[model samples]
Target: MNLVLMPMWLLSGSVFPASEAAGWMRVVIAINPLSWPTDALRGSVLGEPAGVFAWAGAAAF
Candidate 1:
């Protein structure tokens, strides 16, 4: 599972902002399940409002 999950975590934008990713990479980031909670937590810590999609994605998992 590390093989699958590790890449997902790496693509989750936890290390870098998704905005800085290339177009195709951004698409990968968008589909990564981990990105949702990462984005939600990042937004909470940064005092930015998390998007509805972020919450929904997190809740889905």
Candidate 2:
């Protein structure tokens, strides 16, 4: 599962800010199931509140 999980992890905004990603890559990040949890954790660690969409995405997974 490394092949799948690795790419998902990379695309989940964990390696770089999602905002800096290309438009198409942002779309990919949005669809990645791992992005939500990664966002939530990042927000928590940074003391930034996660948006509603992040919570919703986390819940969805």
List per-prediction Cα lDDT, in the order shown.
0.93, 0.92
| Top candidate by lDDT | 1
lDDT of 2 by residue, 1-61 (tens): 9989899999999999999999999999998989998898888889999888888888888
TM-score between model 1 and native: 0.92
Least accurate 10 contiguous residues by lDDT in model 1: 52-61
TM-score of each: 0.92, 0.84
| Most TM-score-accurate candidate | 1
Model 1, 9-51: lDDT tens per residue?
Answer: 8999998999999999999999899999999888889999999
Residue-level error in angstroms, candidate 2, position 34:
0.4
The number of clashing residue pairs in each candidate reads: 0, 0
lDDT of 1: 0.93
